[model samples]
Target chain A: MTRPRVTFWRLFIVASLALGAYSIFVRFHEGIGGATNLSDGTPWGLWVGLDILTGVALAAGGFMITAVVYVFGLERYRPIVRPALLTAFLGYLFFVIGLLVELGRPWNIWHAIIYWNPNSALFEVAWCVMLYTIVLALEVSNLIFERFGWVRLSRVFHAVVLFLVIAGVMLSTLHQSSLGTLFVIAPGKMHALWYSPALPLIFYVSCMCAGLAMVMVEAFLSQRFLKHPVRVDLMARLARVLMIGLMLLTLLRFSDLWLRSALPLAFQPTEEALAFWVEVALFQVIPIVVLWPERRRASPRRLFVGAFSAVAGLVTHRMNVATTSFVSSSPTDYFPTWMEFSVSIALVVAGVVVFWGFAKWTPLFAEGEHPPHAAHRAEHVTRARPGPPTAISGCGRARRGARRLPAPRRWPGGRSTAPGTRC
Target chain B: MSKGMLIDITACTGCRACVNACRTKNRLDAPPGARLSETDFTVLEHRDRLAVRRMCYHCNDPACASACPVAAMVRTPEGPVAYDEHRCMGCRYCMVACPHGVPAFEWHSRMPRVRKCAFCPDHVAEGRPPPCATACPTEATLFGDRDALIKAATARIDARPERYYPGIWGRDVAGGTSVMFLSPVPFDRLGLRTDLGPDPLGHATGRILALVPGTAATVVTVLGGTYWLYRRRAAVAAEQALAAARDGADAAAREGREGGR
Candidate 1:
């Protein structure tokens, strides 16, 4: 059988390459010193805060997808694995580029790799990212190989896939949260409300939440582009994630406050404390409202809103942690430069392009397999009958990826295997 | 023994001459971005009316040195927190973990790194005043031996009990800093974060978290290797499944033909 068409891969490549090139020019011309707002008092800026730290957290969907589908045997994510892994792949690509642009002595970056001291926190992030990107590329490349009639090679490769999946998960688990640990040393520099010994733990947990939110965006966009309805079950799963993220974030906030027990002043006529509380309320409290059992069943739109809100909350959290929290004493307070912002914009465009190519080419939206279930339900009241749906099975790359379920072939539901039912 | 400086905020007038002098001496560009990256070696942070000139508060057990997985930030026996750019991966964990947020990332450069005060050890080695100290017209930012500086700080605090804070900023903070602060108000009030506990973050987390990098390395290589292997296995199973499927199809086709005959 012929493969599906990928209309936009070329366009995506061109756009991503162009954006990267532009950012490279900006990075070189300004020099990290002159272009960024980082000061002697505050050396770190938004590129570190948002792009490197939060960006990695948001891209966690790939690990989460693979983990659920492979390790936990959650078959539902099979359809999402390829796309997730691909996104994870590109996310790391952008991350590497961003770092290169940020580095002052970009030429000497290899020195750190070769002459590792094994005592720096950054060395850990560097090596982990370096290794993890390779893992991601390798994982995603299998699909390309599978599609290209290299089935035998892919077979040889499958022997260690599980081990790789497990390792990828472990590395992601460590590095994702370590982004937060970056701030743990700043107990004195960070505002009291934002600083805590539990920062590493908090960071880890927040990324998990961010991962879900990221997938929610993925699911939402996939639905929008594919013109397929987002699954109610998927929304249910997302709501569950939001509930856990927001609840734990709330718990952590309160616990940190309780430990210090001087948090009251943070909420009173003070700008800093107010920023803290507002972030909590916006990012956490409101999202939990619609995640209740009663609400989860009633609406998908509500779920979408909840996910978006949580994502917003997560972004704000990153900004606060990276910027607002350390506003005092640190002379450097960061705002994104034009090139930095442009590059970030380019990243979003790249994600769209990737999503577009995946949707157009892959079996991700195939009819018998990837039928629009939500659409059927939405128009169920008016349609006399709905067409046959595909059966998707398999445990890893598919959600029940290759599971062969008998499609209903009956009229008014009478007997017969519907024609062209194989998926 | 390595010498140090103790800043008695009681003496500082926020003159900022030291900030200019260090920048001039180091040839650091005027801060174009945020205030921190603009200057090097010496910088100023203002809280309310008090000014704190911050450089490197090199510690006896510096958190940056310990937090570095690559040992980029090394602590000298004499107590200077020196950075080796060649060994830095630009992860900025030191910037995040520093109690004073002293470690700064050169965020704009392609080969950026963590930059912070190195105690002007070169000049100090020559038995000359550190640039900032020599530049301080008001003598607000001072330099001396570690023991002598603390003794002088204590003497000042003792002689003018009402004028200075009851406690020293760095003597007990993070196991003692090469640079100490003297303030009229409490260190906490001036936004000179003193909340970091007596134990350096390195001692508190190094043993357990240091494994993070090595563990990460092991996990990445192992996982990368494993994933490659897993894909191969799945492909073999798939081929086997396909063969079984074809044989089943052929058998069914034969039966239908035989029945028709």
Candidate 2:
């Protein structure tokens, strides 16, 4: 039987790209006023808040993977690093493009470099994002260089990989937390429900949870989509990271709620209050319940759902803080236009397509941690022709039972009797 | 002399004319108050009954500048928050990290960026004033040296303690505000969150951060260099191991072929 082929994502991307391009041209001619719904009352709407700030945090899965692999020497995560980096790279790339279009004087966007502006938080965010993107690009480029047989270039990049990795890690850390700092200034405007001194720190830590959740979801989907079996060891490790981040996130929230005298407000039973309770319930409480256990984390289905819930919770929390919970008596109420949603869709779909194409074409999957199921995952059709197998059976799929390095070949040291293979 | 802009929200009428003037003077899109883009610097926001003219105050020690791993948001000596989108990675962390909720992120479309008010330093440097200050119909906002703004803010507070209520903002809030404010109503009533203390928001975490560029540069260089060396060693070992494995595989394949022959 032929495997199910999906064209929806690619087709959707083409449509959105067309719209985005058209809208961009329209911006040039008529200007952004005609294109966006931003107003003096509601200065930033969906594009500025949702697609960029929130999106960047979601894409943070890349650096966390790298840190695990290179910094902590978690050899098991090495395989997932390339894919995670690719996702991070594309997420930032889309963000970069989206930001460029938003620039009023696109040409003068470089003035921040020639003339320093140490007085602005935006300035730091800009520089960090720029430098970090270059770092991520270099990290991803190493994979390409190795794949193309450019041994020397690959060596140079590999030598510098640690630098790029560390840089990426540091950059992600600063900006991730800084996102909360943006809203900290508006204590009056933000609902007492969400505002706190530790907001920036909380936002940063929350990203850790969101990113790990996305990684879990990505792992499951990739396993199914790419026809690779999930590696148990890597999944277990990833689950542990998610568990730790969530635990910390929970502690931070509780401590902050206590310090601010805001704990009682959560009990008022208002809509915002209820939403808060529900969000925490999903993002922190429920996930903790399912994830605190090692056995549950090891299960693929449980891990996926738990991670999805955590990511959803974080995303909602961001939206709440940025817009929903904070009812700045400000005259603006922002809603992303269909065009905005289209653009967001385009970025996500593009990242997916890129990941799939790059994986098929390049050696991106040669990561340090090929999941515990490396043998099973790697036991796909030959690279030349990726097709369904002749007979789908337990033996065919389970042929990779002893894929570990220490494990002897399946069926013991049984060398092929017919082929004069060295025993 | 560290100079800063003084913003008196009581004088603002929500006209957004200052936004228009800033855009035209800044060579921006001149979009109406509704169509805010990254170019629409000095946008206006109506919080409750308040008309907050949003712009980047040329802070004395800005979190944005210090957080910058690269020198993108450099505060001019005179005190203007200038930006370079090209140098910016569009991370939008500044939007997230800013204490005043001033910086805006560009989150839509194919290409996005940040949009914030850079004080009209070009005109100010030429001995004029910021466009927002000049364009205000009610003179709710003023452009002057930091000292004068502080003095004026203090006098207003001293003269009418009951009228001003609480205290003058930026006088001691979050280190200090480059743009000072004098409100007729309570600041909280005006939808401005004035609860932040004078402590540097960055330092509020109770951790002292090295914010200078030279220090950050050194840290980046040292960290990067250290990681590079470690990775080089690891890559070398991994390569040697891979080479050995490949050689063994090739020899085994050759033996198998010869045996078949």
Candidate 3:
């Protein structure tokens, strides 16, 4: 049953990748005008709105999960941390590719490194994204080190894991808020309903909601495809956290509008007003309502619905901010071309394919306590008491089943010394 | 002394001499269309009886310069904002940040650069007025020191209250622009934005970015302190667990010896 589905996905990914490559070649050969719908009036289209902004915002899960486990010392949440990190790393890697396609002079992208513009909000965002991507790479490297049995190197990373987590959180906060700051300079061009003096604060709050909901979405997907177990208690707690974030975001949005006296704009019978209401409903109202009851929060299906809604809502909000709000001011109309949409969809597919490869090849969902170094064995041993059924327990069963089944011939080693055993 | 321009809309005729002069001076290939583009640095738009010439305001604190991530857009001390194409990465952020929406991009080029009014920096440096200002049939466009031009604009407004708008259009808008305008009617009716306010737009973004260092310091201290507290607590718990287990073993051994006796 699974074989046919797996082959279908593989074929789909390959076709998408080929189309993306052709579109990219056309972009470079014919220039941005021939390839994209973007014009001088609308210099940014789907590449900036969906691929860069939405993609980066969704990847906030990496910092959120790491802070929960490493900084807050919640050891029970350890099993999901590696998966979240892998997702984030792939998300950022694809963001760079999207940016390359969007940039008019792709080769000069490194000019931001040598040149300085401390006053520019974009300058801050560029620096932070570069730094944070590196930070995430280092954090995810522990899995690689363990898979190859580089115990000493992994120990070095383990020793300073706390510092790395703290830095990642700080970098994430800066860039995430600075994205909103980019639009703050153009109050006259942006619609009053979307424009506010507190935009940076609003962006930061909304990202927290998106980040938490994204983790839940990933958890549900992995459980279905990878045969990983879903921890009902842990997911319930995450749902509670997501509910609080959604509430905070709602409060921030309404209060900002109210304070600016732009609340009346939301009631107007206009396209902008409709978009705003839809965004609020998808991101704020629906998630909060679905996750309100304890029984619904515990049910995996309900939790997935709420998470998917929040993620969809985040995409809507970002698109509205990036494109729709400028409709009244822009001289020309912008709708992304088929080539643009293909490239964006292709980047997303590429991310999924890379994540799947990482999951299959590495010990991404290893069972038991996985301390990177033996130095941390004492801490793990002390906290080794059995708790609720988790992904860890599910992974142990999966490992045993894998031993009986035929292992893939492509692997360098046999089943006994596979990637998961060392870790 | 900063250079500036004062455009008196009341004096302009519907002739297009300035537009022709600007095109000729820049060596542009074709005649300008209805709007600004890479080929047209300035354009004259007809609004009822008045003819308004639109170009870069050359703001005192330009949002474009502040918005450029690589310092590609720069504000010259001579009062005009300049573009350094070699430094630009073509992010198009300046186009987004501009209040008047002046910057134009070359979408058809493989390596596009942002294009806008240069304010004739070369002409200004050589002590000659811009070609458009010199080519004006009437004294519609005047170029001189920014302060003298502001005084001239105020004098014109004060003398002809009935003929012109009540105030100088660019005197305080967006924290004061080097190029001021005298319009027969309200500026907004002429497609100029009046709601940009008196503060520089860059100040808003600057204020947010200024808080970064403090935010980073606070995060580090809090997270570091919390991790230390948790590790210490775990160590103490582990020591207690080990001591309790040892005690249980000693009791079992003693009870076994007593039973044997």
Candidate 4:
């Protein structure tokens, strides 16, 4: 393998990490008042809004992709599953880290685990987030175990993998919606343009779209970096799914406004109205326009544009709902301090760096029948040649069993090599 | 049986004695700036010469108590909503959930806690008026049974209809706060919200959340069934493949025997 070189992006991430470390120190040493623009009026600033909320919202793709592959039995989407799982696991890890930093007493955060508060929406969110992260860790560990040739452990993980996926989907559904439930209490504080009894439902649906979009965007980035071929057709199909979700969200939100006599509020010339329009136009409208056409869907770049647009829109929607909408009602205005921004940016960079590192080490994109690395590939080839007993008879038996198993239909993409065949 | 306070805003002199009394009683330092803080729970707001004391309303159905994940903020039987600093993890959900925005967080503290008026639990437990009420020489804030305070407020309103706004704040706002208000001008003009409905803010979400058990059961059943079906199909396919391979091997052996004969 070629030695990894010092790239601009890598240098940028290192510098950001250094700055982020200092900002985090300031946060701990000086407290929130010194490090953040949060106040009595605006208690939840960019940390809660951008870091935690948006972080979880973007991580929705993990459950979505896992459900698509495992539950729905879509064999074609298997290639993207590990990457999605890795992204989600990292996304949630950083979310927890952000929660620790944003929280006033980070040590006391575990109280939610020991103490039961069935009444609080945040309690539900806290529980679900904790449980789902555990599930993701188990799911993603399949790749890690496979990397180290831990066959017995990998077999054990597979034995309960489906159940874990179902539980993840259920927990994800609960908390993704409950994040909206956090805002349900602040009806007076939240703008009518965003607030509704159906916020949970809206949030649930939009997150599904956000998750799918994230998977699409991540798939493109991963394919580019990992030297894997782009599955444009599969991504186009995913875009269609995102479009359906976006349409449902747009319909639900506007009709909800109409029923509540708040539709006129959207048309009014105000910042909230403009923000609402921007969210709709950028995320909901533009993606629908770009991905709706068959010709547009055929282009890989177009698919990415649609996905990125939806991702950006979903992020903006969460930020607007969480922070921007409350500004008018708040006693003091809020803009994130430089330290707050640095910490948030650093968290994202950290996630990407971790993902990059994992992809380099693990067989995240390899088919289940095959292990990664040229050495592993050579070993599999020798085992497949029916001449003599392989030195490792156990590996040989495993290879024979894998070959006997029914291979899924060869997907139409470049480098379509059978498992155990040298690529 | 819960105690409450009826603050007649028209009678207040804007002297801020209640604010001073609360700080002195709680032994909390007065942070600079007149805004509410961890130290200063009560603030006297003057709007066009009419003064009103702004603090935690100590609602009969307090949103903060319901929003608190650990029950750190709980309503007392004696009527004041109090905070247990020991139990507090300080997630500050109460701050977000408060319609009145009464709960203030200790942003500067290393070991932070949520801060708000507890309606003087020591005074309520001892059958004495809260410090603020005790300090009000004008009887602007009268402490008694909630029903009695409501009756007195109605009688006062009926006696001189022109002196009041004709609506008592917190009578039904957020399902009746322990601290009710009377004003000459509108409640909104005094930095109080009038738009909050009678229902508890936490009730709707709680009702939806109550269905989670049923939702979980249904999800498990559906997914479990799907898993079973997928496993069954894989098993059936493997069996069929084994049967076909056996038939081919037997036919190849028979052909070889015939050729040898």
Candidate 5:
């Protein structure tokens, strides 16, 4: 009954939480002025730039995965549905937490529900995000019910799961585009390199890429750390979708620039221009290069790198849109204080911890009847851990050599039954 | 009728009386910078020899009102974009959406609210001129009917064509703001944004948002139909397989019975 030994990741998370707690104290005690470097000209800073915007974009995977599995009937992806939902739910929960820290009057946030401004795009986004969080909670409750052996509750959830999923998809679509719509009023404030009338379309398309890439990254991480059996074919299929999304996003973005006669701005020796190009390289060029190879594309590590690159690119893009785009118009130079950065980093660590905890406690990767590794699935352990592991020993075992545990029945590179096909 | 202000930069001395009057009238702190803040609603700035007073334009179709998620900032019929601190959620979208960068935040305070000029609606309600306007010695900041102000602004530019800039700022920019400016130099040179077109800033975003309902309905129908079709086909396949298995079992039993007979 001894707790697992603490690893570097666990130690890092703990340290971050402690440091961030102090900053949170300062923020509440002394107000935003003491904790952040934000001014009247630069009111939205790291919290809006990284924590809320990028966080929400990354969470897009939940709706996409649910749509693929439930609406399209892609049963192959059923294994990853719960994990995707968990990641999204945690992402959004932390997003709201970050917003609370950022908002001057967080207590009045519920006012958005009571007062409706039909003309305001932020109003739409606020409403959709609020509603979607509820929808996601309901969608994700099935796993919790099953884990607790609430058979009747689980049955009720199943009956309404499809309705919840449909509502989620609709809500996500509204807010995902609405985030971009928030910037439309700032045509003069935002640099020409990032501003366009087609911003909503660009945002929607890029969200698809972010969502697909995040799903791939999640699938790879669970396979790596949780020691879930590898499903290379599934990852490969998702990669293809990610690649297609990246291409469409690139095409749309470049076409927008070209049509607006803003293409010249991209070549300028300015910070905004350089950032734009970096976004293109990370989100568009690198992922395309990595996923182009049939063999390498199927490799779990390679796919993961590509997916991570795409996610990173999208994060940068969102940050650019939210904060960097306004730099030219800002009265003073803005850089986030250490306290702000720590708070953001802490939120991420908190999210990761919650995701890892949920994966361990619930049947996130309990592969179903048609699992590739049916033997392994048959031996699946539903035994609840006495308490949470202080750290993952799986990482250590992975480093020492994977010889400690039984090898997966099949590797992604080959069919296990065919000797010659094994890589 | 809606009111307005016409500020003639050429007539004003850099005495800053209007700035002081604004602070005293609004009960705000004496701020150091020429920019608007929670404590500073209006600031008197100098461009070479010309003295200019800066504050909210109070647009006919206010972008801040449009961008406010909770309608905390509302444009009144009397030509003021008023803010209700009690209704504010502190989202700061209004600050970002304002074309003139007029809205300021109470960043230093724990319970902050958006701070901006409301065109001195209290005085206008009493059928009196705004404090800034009344305090101006040269009538540099004129307050009256929006139409009369525009006509006067145009006449000044036309009568002394060599002394004034041709365009009357806020006459059409951002859908004709209630506060207009007449300057000797170009409006941009005087720190006013001339880039905003006549149409309201919210119009573009509004058009895009209008598509949401139709798009959502379409998606729901299409996706729902797809799910229904897929489920029905799966159910049909299952039923056929069950029937086939039963028929094979019945035939095998009959054959065994016939052989025994």
Candidate 6:
């Protein structure tokens, strides 16, 4: 049963990748005019809206998790930190790729590096994203170094891990907010419901929520598919943080709208108002209600549902902000072509396939294993132990069995007393 | 010294001479379209009795120039907003940023570039008016210094209040533009955006971007401080645990010696 299911997924990924390649060919061969429904009135469409905007926001988990574990010294979350970093690294890597694909002159993407336009929000976003991606790459490189048994290199990375985490946080904060600042220039073009001077602050807060939600979703997925143990305690705490973030975002959005006297716009009979309400319901109301109770937060299934809703809400919000809001002002309407959809799906499939590869081959989930780095020694004293060679073994039974195992012993230095015990 | 055009919509005869002259000057082969496009840098829109010439306004603080991340769109001192196609990465941000919906893209080309009126800076520099303005049969498209043109537009409106819209369209729209317009009716009636306020659109984003350095500094300081505090707490806890273990061991050793005696 498992073999067949795995084969089915493998075939799906391969097919999606093939279709994606063809889409790329069409996009480049036919140019944007022939391939997309976009026009002069709507220059940025699905690719900019989804692949770049939503993808980058969803990847905020890397900075959030790193800040939690390293900056706050939350030793229990250390196991998930590497996974989160890997996700962020891939998210940004694909964002750059998406940018290249969407750009009319992909070769000239480097012009942004040499040209100085401090006044342009995109210029600031481009610089921050570039620096942050590099920071994320360095953060995730520890897993690669560990996979190859490059103890010295891993140690070198660990020595400056704190510095990297701090830098990542700063960079992520700037770019995430600057993404919203991109829209601040065209106040007349965007619908009143999504436009505001406080957009940068609003984006920053919502991304925090989305980032935490993504971590929860990723955790649930890894546990179910990869046969990894789910740390319910840690996830519940994360859910609490997500709840606060969502509440804060909701407050910020509504207050900004109310202060601007645009709240009445939400009640108007227009498509923009409809989109705005839907965004609000999905992004705020549904997730907050689902994750409100402590019991629900503790239940992995319920938590996954909430996180999934939030993720979906985030995509909707970004799409609205990036594309839908311009509908009224744009002379022509735009709906993404099948080619655009295929390319976006292909990017996601590629991300998951790479993540699956890392999980299968690397010690991405070895709970107590410490890299041979002096920086880590102060936090954890556990000796390294190789995790299961195949992370995808007996799914439901393995999780149940893991739950029944006795809690691992801990020493005064917070090291596992029983070195060989699985978490 | 900034040059501009005073377009008198009331005087326009709905003739295509100015459009033809523009095509000739730019050496454009494609026939003129009804709307502004890659090939049609300028278009004549017929609204009832008015023939509005739609083109780039070339604002004092141009949003397209501010929005271009690569500095591909530049506002020259000579009053033309020039596009450096070689530098553009085809982000198409200028199209979205322009309040007038001006900057058209070459969506059909593999190596696309943003298309719009160049304002003919070279022509003006050479002491010649733009071809479209020079070709205007009724002198409806008058080219001169921006300040002088605004004054001329005001005088025309003031002299015959019923003949004009009683106000200059671009005197302060979007923080003032080089191309001022005089119309027989309200500007909005001719499908122009009158809602854009008197501030440069870039100011909205500029205000936010100015906070970036301070934001980065605060983030770094707060994160660094939090890490230090947490590490110190962890260190203190570890020391207490170590001292407790040492004391227990000593107590055990003393008890064992007493028991042996």
| lDDT string, candidate 5, B1-261, tens digits | 989999998788878888888888888865557778878888887776677788998999988899999999999999988999988988888988988888988776788888888788889876689998999999899999999988898888889999998889898898889889998889899888888888999898899999999989988998899988887776787679779999999999999999899
**Error of model 3, residue A399, in angstroms:** 31
Worst ten in a row by lDDT for model 5 chain A? A413-422
Candidate 2 C-alpha lDDT tens digits along B1-261: 666776676667888778778877867754454433466666676766777666665566565655543455667777777776667654444554455556665534334556777776677677578776788887677777788877887776787776665466666666676776677677766545476667766454323122334445765676666656666776687679779999999999999999999
Best by DockQ: 6
Candidate 3 chain B lowest-lDDT run of ten: B230-239
TM-score of A-chain in each prediction? Answer: 0.78, 0.80, 0.87, 0.87, 0.86, 0.87
lDDT score for residue A303 of model 3: 94
Each prediction's number of clashing residue pairs: 80, 48, 0, 0, 0, 0
* lDDT of candidate 3 at residue A143, scale 0 to 100: 75
lDDT tens per residue, model 2, A36-106: 66543344456665667767887899988887666655556666777788878887888877777655545
RMSD of 1: 10.4
CAPRI band of model 1?
A: acceptable
TM-score values for chain B across all models? 0.75, 0.69, 0.96, 0.91, 0.93, 0.97
Residues A1-423 of candidate 5: C-alpha lDDT, one tens digit per residue: 123544766788899999888998888778788899888777788889889888888889999988887887776787778888988898899999998888888888999989889899999999999999999898887778766756446545755778888999999998998899988988888888888889888888898899889888887877766667767888898898898899899999999999999999888889889889889999999999999877787688889999999999998898788777788888876888999999999999898888888888876666342654453343222112332121234444232222312332221111121111111
- Residues A131-164 of candidate 3: C-alpha lDDT, one tens digit per residue: 9999999988877876777744665676567778
User: Candidate 4 — which pairs collide?
Assistant: none
Cα lDDT tens digits for candidate 6, B1-261: 889999999989989788888899888789779999898988899886779999998999999889899999998887889999899999988988999989988888888888888988789776579999989999799999998898898889899998888888898888889888899999999988798889999988998899999999999999999987876776787789879999999999999999999
**B-chain TM-score, candidate 1:** 0.75
RMSD of each: 10.4, 11.0, 7.1, 4.8, 9.7, 7.3
Which of the predicted structures, 2 or 6, would earn the higher TM-score when compared with the native? 6
Writing each residue's lDDT as its tens digit, candidate 1 over A13-32 gives 67666875677576687666
Off by over 4 Å in 1: A1-24, A33-36, A262-266, A269-274, A294-298, A331-339, A362-423, B6-40, B43-54, B67-71, B85-97, B101-117, B126-145, B148-169, B180-193, B204-261
Can you give the TM-score per candidate against the true fold?
Answer: 0.73, 0.66, 0.91, 0.89, 0.90, 0.91
Candidate 6 lDDT: 0.85
List model 4 lDDT by residue over A1-423, tens digit each: 234544767788888999888989988887878788888888888888878988999999999888877876666677788888999999999999998998888888888877777988888888999999999999998777777766556656765777889999999988999888888878878888888888888889988899889999988987766666778988988988888899888899889999999989888888888989989888888899888977788899889999999999988898788877887788898888899999999999999889988888987777532322343445445445664332234466455534543342212111222233221
Ranking by lDDT: 6, 3, 4, 5, 1, 2
For candidate 5, give the docking quality class from DockQ. acceptable
Count: clashes, candidate 3:
0
Q: Rank all candidate structures by their TM-score, best first, as comma-separated numbers.
A: 6, 3, 5, 4, 1, 2
lDDT of 1 by residue, B1-261 (tens): 767887878788877887777777777875722244524666677876778776678888887787766677888876678898876656555766677656766555556667666777687766577878887777777888888888888888899899987887888787888788888888888666576667877765554466575766775676566545665665687679779999999999999999999
